[model samples]
Target: MHSIHNRLFLLFLSCMMALLIIGSYLYYRSTTEIIHDKIGDMAEKNISQTAGLFDLLLEGYDSVTKSLNSNYELLRLLELRDKETNPAASANMERSITNILGAAFYSREDIIGIHVVTHKGKLYNYEKRFAGVIDPGFTDTDWFKKLKDSSGEMVWMGLYDGSVINTMQKEAVFVFGRQLYDLDTYKKIGVVFIETDPKPIWAAMSNVTISPNSRVYIANNENRIIATTEKDGVETPSFSGLPRPDSDHVIVDKSTDQLIVAAKAELADWTVFGLTPKADINAQVVEARKYLLIVVLLLVVMSTALATLISRNIASPLKLLIRQMRQVEMGNFTGTVNVNSFEEINSLVSSFNRMVHRMDELIERITLASISEKNAELQALQSQVNPHFLYNTLDMIYWMLDERENDRLGRVILALSHMFRYSSDWQEASRTTLRQELDQMRHYLTIIENRLEGRVRTEIRIDDAWLDVMLPKMTIQPIIENAVKSGLEPLNRPGLLQVYTRTTQRELCIVIEDNGIGMDERTLTELQTALSDGSSAIRGNEGHVSAANGGTAGDRAVMKRRGIGLPNVHRRIVLMFGEQYGLRIESKEGAGTTVTIAMPLPSKGRKIDEHTDR
Candidate 1:
């Protein structure tokens, strides 16, 4: 979760997907509306053109009806037929009427037949050859009555399977008729009916098809579907449910699953309606959506790839910089971050490099100054101890030589020579092993035992295993020397000094305990307080060393004449290790004093030289 690459990739991907989804939705919405509107408009225009074509065809039919109705010769024959009484003469007049009807039928090729019925019940018919004979009840038919009722106006009788006046003429026909009148008298003499093939009307409706599944219908004023392109038994919508037709403009109704485009034909009481299923209408839109989806998918893939690449580009350099920073934290400041990346990241890396370099320099300077300070303090403390200790040792040897102690003279000189050699050499190391410190202490004790003539005694009970532990040079010598002067020298009885080692889980302790008259509580408290106050290791001892008995000022002066005391040793140990490891003193008036030096437990083969100046 802390990985920057994953975070950046997810952030970029989410933003891109959101934009793509919103943009696609908006574009698709607008496109669908535009396509739907365009398709509807095209269908309406097609249906309107078909209606206009039907108007032309109907106009031709109307002209044919007018020519026959207004012909003077045809009217003269009809009048002659009505006036004649003889059967043979009336038959000839009938033939003359038949010739006139035959000529009118031949004038128009679409016309299937022409029939004229006089007001006196005589009929003249001219029709296709082999057409069926006329029906005897033709005058009693609804179409004939409608024609009679028309006052010289044409009446359209829609479509029929055969001629209205002829029986068994099974070809579909479009029929229309008008009452014939004598122009001068303005009187109706008879009704004329013309039958034409309905194929041209059907072609007009079919020619404007918008789709393969589209159905075209010719609906009348009453919304009855008179003609349609749909096959029989195919389900069709109720025309009454469609919007009312307007002759001046096309109307589109989308109340159903089909797209309905309708317009009224100019010359007839008919509306041409085109119905196309919505599925077919939106097929193009579906295809467009498919392509759009493909494009979106491709874009998404590209966006993901780009996001991953950018995240990696930005995060890779930052990760490298973090690794370098961690190395610095581990005290390895030598490494520098180097990468080719964006300008901002490069700048950050440059700043980090500069910081590492500056830190390395500052730490080196601080370490040098600390080491100088520690060396100066060690030199000062060593200077304070050597003069007083050397004088005391030399004076003891002078006394021994004066008393003519010839037998022990060589041993005392040998011990004094070793002590001077060990203490005066400050060029090498300022620390020594516990075994070496103990050996030096043994040499000093031997001299003390000889001087006091067995009045003072010493016991060293350190384990051989702890002999290899390292501590500061002169660490044990001063503490043992101070114990001999302050506690054992004033003893009225034989004095005993013991040195032993103790161990805990985290630290090792060197306990130097002496059987002598110990200091009082006030002195012990003052000594402890001096240790806690971080007393300087090389400071003068006027206030630090208190008298061992009765807290006398002369005793304090005598102690001052001695070497550096436990407080300076405690200060040195605390500086070398940390504050947690230091010196603790337990002493009671008239009882023995125990000075326990506490130090860290170093692992096997561990070197502590680096902490000498700490």
Candidate 2:
């Protein structure tokens, strides 16, 4: 009903008036009541007190780092420079002995001393600042064995009593240590440790002034609150001061709010939580409004100016462009927005027009050209996978034929014949029993075993209960392929692959575990990207997900290639079942990997049928 220019100007005026009125009212109410004062006081305490506590937590983690560096110093001292060498007595290694002890006792005012043993069982330590020659025979210690066996450049120890560090009747502190290696030769240097005096972290919070009675509870990233002033004791995980959505500030996270918690973060990942009387927070805010009014007025003027400028510069063009956009909303593509003032907006209109024209042409051409070329490429690559599999199967059949000269070739042929027949049918991802899928996997692995000459071993634990439990068709193949192609291939050593299915607490969990060398972090990251981008945005949920392995979905559909195995398998399962059911991959270096697919078990009244393509 209104012209574009008039409507935009009116909207601009309305926004300005709203800002002014809202700002004035907020300013007046906040000033008239002193509520903001309490918030300011609480905020100040939270920032300063929490900041100190935050620094302390960081110091703890840093003490851990400095403790790690102590090991580096120890390596330089022992000249056991490489990780493999036994850390025996050495003059060069003795120079850093003080730092090693320093780091070992850095946070631990309680620890009076520390002892280390070389592989030959010789002892190392300065017994006492006053007393001399305490037996440093630190044999049969877990830290010693762990230090010797660990391959990591730096290994961190969990909490240990300071008894070893302090045999004296006096000083005792908890200790955490790390192992060090020679930078070049990769030989083991001696272990370095730091004793922690958990007191300092609490000391930082002791002075946090909150209504004279409030308390601060600190928790590390792991939700472990090392120390608390509460006499009630942190017996369980019940120390508060964490995240809460009810009040923008939470007194204690994941627990009841008998306490008002203002939670914040430190320089490190540690969460700093301060609990004050809720009455105090409300009290502080009560007196704050009077003083904050001056600030609020200035803010209101600034906000009004900002709103007007934004409206004139941004909303004005968008409003004007809306006329053209309305044409778009009306399904008109040959239209263009008026090139009034904003250069980018003018350019955007031009680009939008060009895109509309280009897209129409592309759609028409793409629809025609896509099916032939894509189908051709799919056919070729698909064949490469099938032939390689068949050759492996035939080679195995040949071996069996040689071994069992009187073999019933018919049985082997029937199995291989059914496998290829299913592979070609491509009518999978419907309802099927777990027994059938495992059968398919067995046939596939037979071909692999033929290639590996029994070097690759597989144990299929088709549990009795899961025999009739149905799953999406061919859901297990890609996971198997990924495990074999990526996980097992690098091992060079023969490995084990186990497939197990089970239902627990109403969920069907199918797990495939392999003992082959697992992928590194970079490979996992790639796999994640491949999985996430498998299905792109389409008009509805019924669109196809291209399984271009190791490729991201994008406007650059030109070279889009998704992996068929994992992505396709994951999509089919999730689409058939619900999103709660999906593939989960876990792997560690040299430790192998486990891929688990989880889905809801079928209901009693339900029956599974292959969901045919529409």
Candidate 3:
């Protein structure tokens, strides 16, 4: 015997443990998804808004360049060629252009310097100190070439050091350039370059990042990083792995533990990438998981302790019962178990005490009646064999052979003989493999079909996998007999019988269904009541089985003549495999009836014994 306390404790613990594990997994998964989605949405919104701000800033600078291009005085000065011959006229034009450039520079506090490079290699600069210069090599610079090749569109030339004229100012500045054209000639004459302090743009990007380690940068269509916010780590933000700028707003790259959100600037062919680490984005989820794990562990401990106490309380009564059982096994039937616990356990104790008392009394009288009772029981067992069925079957076979003498008659005789021999040969064991049982049922079905003259059709649809399982002998045959006699025989139309098998995680099921005259509601209720009444015998008095089958007097007599009924089969199954495995019946008045025999899968090397008739 095993310790009932431990079994109870483990059962409780296992149930709670499974529930906790499943619940925790679902909670963690949902929380992580929610956190990821929330962070992605926020990141996308922030990047989009920052891109808008950056575009507006660029547009403002473009407007300034357009205003300068339209200045009549500045246009005339650039078109003038006599500036080299007339120093007075050249000096006046240079001062006038300087005033115009200075007025545009002071319009925005962020503007650092503005320089104009003419196609003739002449350079003009306007800055905080107005230190102008005329550098001939300005046309050879990359920024100047980019501006000249820009056609008529404004070009943002990324961040660069201070201009040549204002080399003393070491601060970095973002430069915008455009090619200036002579309106009347339709030819490019000069390039206008405007530089702005990068502090404001950097501030916009910095405000868009939520984490300290996060990076936000602007990249061209070629994926070159133009500018980025101040970064503390060596990890450089790359836009090459991001999705197309017109696709989804955010992309989560779990491989790199990063979430990237991107937006395209409308003013330029530049994309803004905001990269945030997953660890930082899911920080709350991580903390929640940690606390949930702790709580689950604590709950496990508390539940275990509680289970121990409950199991002890429940096991106390069972332990008392076992002690009494042990005493009885030792031939002392005077002792009885008495323990107070649940009502069910208390009832069990009461029944056990009553049984012991009865056994004690019976033991005193056993010697006086042993011989006579044994002889009577033996005679009853021997008489239990119903000779009428065999006689009728053999007589029918004889008549059929004598009258018809066809292959059909021969087949019926052969099937009947096989069924008789199989049922009578009880010398080997009470249990048989499911395959053998099915074979026996096949023989019985063959005989029934022949007798019914093709009025009955049968179908068997059981999986071969469970054919090797062991079950009680005569388990399915009796149910089939009941279906044929009570359900099918009375039907006016052709009858169909089906036998199939199903399996669950723990139990195997064999189902027998018949399209015959079924029982009404009242008869079914009474039959079900009798089945559940904990009785070992099914009574023929209530008409529960007979009425359901539309039983005639002859059918009732035949049923009574046989010693077994559905109840007997149910009792045997319960005795062998506990109450969890047994027969279930479902029936309708006009349709048919289905009977299910549920059993546990047999373990390896385990043999089940058939219970004696009660």
Candidate 4:
């Protein structure tokens, strides 16, 4: 046992096991105590608040009974009931008494009915319409007897499953009654019973519970449960030796697996108890302890393996260096390697750390240089687009002149001049407002309408509010030209090209739709694939354009030569923003094509709301 290996093994195992067990016990004890105190306090406060609410509710019922008890007209009407000998007069007296009862019934929403029963066996009720006929034998009921014995005071009869006065009233109700007496005679004239729905009482009890499985009980001064949230057949725990009626403090009973918090409802002369299963309260603590055990076991096993590793391996520093080297090979060069060992090994580690530092610096420089070169190339490609577009515009002018179409030649020339000026401002042309871009597009459209002889109709439905949004210059014109030439030109019908904007929470989309000869599936697929090819776009290679709209070889060649416009725009948008913002295209054989340019919305989007509200 004194051997170095055996001694170290036992020492490590014992120390780890002791520390883990002690720490876990401490954590478990602290956690359990905290949860118990916190949950008990919360439950106590909840019951107290609920009890206060019940006090207020019962006080309202007391006030309602007091109002009926002291009303002079009601007492006089009841007294006149005995004196009226004629049948019709007696019936009128009964109506007057019910009228007073109806006033009280309407004052409160919870009241199901207001009932008055006299010693002469006369019954008057002001209840809900269609409440069914009154029970004639209600005078003989136990509740009526209890109310008759009350000394001109309100008697809360707790909750019942039905009304004693109405035959068909079977819903749960909270009932209270009071004896009405004449002011001068101090004599009992009749007894008033107010039957109200028990929803308010149930709500008060439910509000005091901590969990869905927790049971709340309301017990009278005699320790008899008057109202409870316990379901039928569910046994309730005994609440023996609860706090006195005058005590405001809660009595916390911690049994084997249950926690009971009891508080007194001072005004109602009742006790409210919330019984919650301790299993629900300690569920989280148990889970934490289970995880602690698992972690402790894992640590013990790892400690044993570490002791064996230290005993067997004398070159731990070299092993650490090798691990760091493998991490470097995986391209994680963030942390340096430091090891205490022989001079030669330490020297080697120092050299490795220097190498990693230099390599990390070189990698950062290369990344930045690559980004700069990419940006320069994108700028060059955008510069090439303007001259190419100018050549096409001049070619259109030449054709019009050659065909002796002199009527619209001046209009085309004017629009061309405006477009040339707009395109020449290349210093800040990398980005411009959407309004400027649309203005340039309008000029181009003017020339197009003249060149195509009204064969193409352009509609720009962009809201004026979106005019200030900034985008790359010449973005819309290139797409418009492509649509007019490739899609609208070959159409047998008049082409309608529409431009509009759509928005969402994350992005805004500019949609260009054309009711023209749309591309077939093969051609559309090829175009989409070319646009997504970043390498080809960065290398500025002319991508292949498939035969579109069932056109001929010459048509395919024209499209092939002009396909770079879309790719250029897609690449520029992605390079400016990120990979997520780009163009999306949808087309069907004869259903036309919709090209949508999706980009992030502005920071404020104050202009967006102007159109979105519509």
Candidate achieving the largest TM-score: 1
Q: What lDDT tens digits, residue by residue, belong to model 4 across residues 536-566?
A: 4422222222111333347655553322356
TM-score of 3: 0.52
TM-score of each: 0.59, 0.31, 0.52, 0.49
Count clashing residue pairs in model 3.
0
| Order of candidate numbers by TM-score, starting with the best | 1, 3, 4, 2
Which pairs clash (backbone N, Cα, C closer than 3 Å) in model 1? none
Question: Which parts of model 3 are misplaced by more than 4 Å?
Answer: 78-92, 129-137, 161-165, 207-210, 230-242, 247-257, 277-285, 320-340, 352-614
Compared to the true structure, candidate 4 yields what TM-score?
0.49
Maximum-lDDT candidate: 1
Model 1: per-residue lDDT, tens digit, 195-247?
A: 99899988888876777888988878777666778877888778787876777
True-structure RMSD for candidate 1: 14.1
Query: Superposing all C-alpha atoms, what RMSD in Å does each candidate have to the true structure?
Result: 14.1, 47.9, 23.9, 34.8
Candidate 2 Cα outliers beyond 4 Å, as residue runs: 1-381, 384-415, 427-431, 535-563, 604-614
Clash totals in order: 0, 49, 0, 0
How displaced is residue 422 in candidate 2, in Å? 1.3
Better of 2 and 4 by lDDT: 4
